[model samples]
Target: MISPLGQSFRVSKVFKRCPLEIQGFVFSADLIELSFRKFNLILGMAWLVEHQVGLDCVSKRVTLKVGDGEEVVMVGERRDYLSIVISTMVAEKLVQKGCDAYLAYVHDTSAVSSTAEGIRSVKDFSNAFPEELSGLPPDREVEANIDDDPNRAEFWLENTIRVFDELSCTPEECMKCVVSLLRDSTYQWWNTFVSVIPKERITWEFFQEEFRKKNINQRFINQKRKEFLELKQGRMIVTEYEREFVRFSKYAWECVSTEAIMCKRFKDGLNEDIRLFVGILELKEFIMLVERACKDEELAKQKRKAMIEARDTRKRPMSKSFQPQSKRSKETNLRMTISSEYSH
Candidate 1:
């Protein structure tokens, strides 16, 4: 047998047609014994072809067609495949050389969900897996091949950060995911940037700062800050205006450093009718101010609707038969009808 690095080893024995079951699908395969310790078993090309297997390297999953014509999928455990062990002497040398070390506890929970004791254990230690990390990541996008537009860069950075926050990912995990998602010029830039920096110091914050320095311009940020200062609710509804306000507030943090300043700034930008009612309350909380503004806007809308209804009622013409006519007016109408009939 030939190894991946082209080293040759003699096969000790071949076990033919050994039954193997994966995910409830049974198959027979030929197993060969070799002098290799890295893996317990490796499927050969002949077995893969015989089973009509399909492999997705990106997702690390395999699909196999069974005898009954049903396909079964098997997901790979990435950590198992990538794990490595080091001797105590090698570890000591690395420690002496000032190498950073991180320890991760990986629990095998494949059978935990089906067992009673495992269920109780999970309930007792529920904090181990946070609820936020259970679901899929957020749907926000960071373009793989982004341009030099500062707005797009800022959006990408913010969106990446938001996704990391939602997933409760650590700095190391964030860096790994971000590096994987980068492509084209951005990927090249990352490669060059990381070449000189030590791996231990290349944190998420450091990456963000370097990325902003390369992609975002100070002039664009200043412009956005100015826009935030000049922002007004205008024709936007309370909810929409509030969304924009929050989106721009980050650009001008100093202006809204305090809760009172934020509330006051938001109130001052509201429409006149809503501002009149909301401003008088002098609410300190930003959330309360927003709620009050929404309520006042609703009230104003109802008042306008009521006025419109009343005006329409007044302007509506009375029925012709219900109108009171003078005798002279009735006589003139009767004469005109009689004259029209005689002419016809």
Candidate 2:
């Protein structure tokens, strides 16, 4: 599939289906999801040039009866196949996956012991994640990310899927059995309020569909990203500004795809003095920028304090050294002054 940025990635392996053989014709069954948001499965008609597969036009249906077995009746308008499409996220994900595949292919001849191996057996999977619920502590909420960590969600996703694969259950089962592990209000809200499903129709795909319908919203994510982009420290203290930036980090995935971009965006939203201070430093990492901003602000505060103290010292009156008069001398002076006043 081609991404929006003109990048291409492979999704599936090229494989021929086990066909239903007739006098010389063959057919393969296909499972297709009937959604406008879906991509079309390809079928080759080169073989049909010699052997014809009859098509029925009525009832907006097509029938291919090349086989002696039961004819295939496809419920769709008959037209030549045109094109396929994929979502932008899906395309990018595929491209990322393809990179790994390309690397493996290029290094196919490398010794296994030379490379890092992470594969584990099914026993390991079963041991680590038994097909049971792992309840959470009370009031705990499983957030998308944790404590300003950008990789938290990705880490969670990797482990969650590994456990899910080990369980070998439907998504509903996974959700239900997993409920014991979470006592958070968010999880409870999802379990008690959002998890309404017809028992007969419960499936992993349906669960994902409902989950996205109830939880994930692209427009909401986009709005949060916009807020992150426009955020400024303004008059807020360092800690407050950092908190706000961290709070909205998860939504702005694209903005932080690279450390350079993250650094630039974060630098743009900083206060002028902080920006100038941070700019002078060779900071490339987001964490480094946060640390430096905090450090610089503190230094600025100390400098201002020192300047104030110096100004205050300069404003004060200076005291000069003076000798104390003897008691007898003071008394004599006082007596002379009193007598002079009386004579006057």
Candidate 3:
């Protein structure tokens, strides 16, 4: 019988028709709310089973007791197997959630530690839990902590198994007791959720290379390597233009060094060649050329502006004036265009 507060059940049975043998059953109950979108009316069951004997003697069976005292048979493993049953409705829901739900139980026949060490023992599994859940109460507490963190259920269940192991219950025994808490239907739903949930970025290849290096300064080296890889991915490397700029900058420094060499050689000159070099135009000549070019450009600009103004003025074209010679230079007339109405 199931307790009102929800507890696990233990049972043992022997069939008279089969070869004489003993078997144990561990059962628990759990409830799951439906999304109400599909309204699937299917029913199902799941079983978790484990066997530790050399010949593999563990087994789990599930049968649905339907209305009118009838029984519905489901397909699954027979002997030395762990299995879970899921209705069509539940399977669809799990498919939607992106996970598979299964019920499995471990069996232990080890006389050394009994079922406590085999199933519910904390040492049997690794706890890959975050730091947030470390300080919470045990899963078996009368009430869950106020945090109500989404991952609490899994943490609580795993922690409870560890506690059970300390209390002398085997892992197999604890699994049997908690098997029903996980339904095949809900398992599928959880799987789907996990698949679609956003995950933090993780690139293992770079990390692995750093992790394998053998050195006393591995941590610092790995950190630097990680930063470099990130920078590469972010495209912080130099471009063609930047590379050219750096090359030219180095050449400019070389020019300064050459100038220093020239000055020293000039001071040591003892021949006509050195005297001739001193007379040649140097840095000051370059500056004079630049100033001349600038003055020429400014003068050209002023001449162009004056011509434009003269052409645009409201005045007649200038007539050619002839100088009369002493005896009968004929008076000459020149054609001129006149526009007295010009705006300027």
lDDT of model 3 at residue 72? 38
Q: Which stretches of candidate 2 lie over 4 Å from their true place?
A: 1-174, 178-209, 216-219, 318-344
How should the candidates be ordered by TM-score, best one leading?
1, 2, 3
- Model 1, range 213-317, lDDT digits (tens) per residue? 888878888888998999999999999999999999998999899999999999999999999999788998998999899999999999999999998777666
Candidate 2 colliding pairs: 134-181, 135-180, 135-181, 136-181, 136-182
> lDDT by residue for model 3 over 190-218, one digit each (tens)?
34544664544212232222212311144
**Candidate 2 lDDT by residue in tens digits, 1-344:** 65344444455434445465544555664432332244544344554432355654565565565435656555655344332333545644655444322223355566665421354444445556575635423432344422133244234444666787653344655666544443455355556744475566755565445444445556666787888888999998878987888778778787778888878877888888888999988689988888899998898889999999998787664422355778999999999999999999
CA lDDT of every candidate: 0.82, 0.62, 0.37
Model 1 residue 42 distance off true place after TM-score fit, in angstroms? 46
Error of 1 at 248 (Å): 0.1
Best by TM-score: 1
For model 1, the stretches where C-alpha displacement exceeds 4 angstroms are: 1-144, 318-344
TM-score of each: 0.53, 0.37, 0.13
Q: Is candidate 1 or candidate 2 better by TM-score?
A: 1
Clashing pairs in 1: none
User: How many steric overlaps are in each model, in order?
Assistant: 0, 5, 26
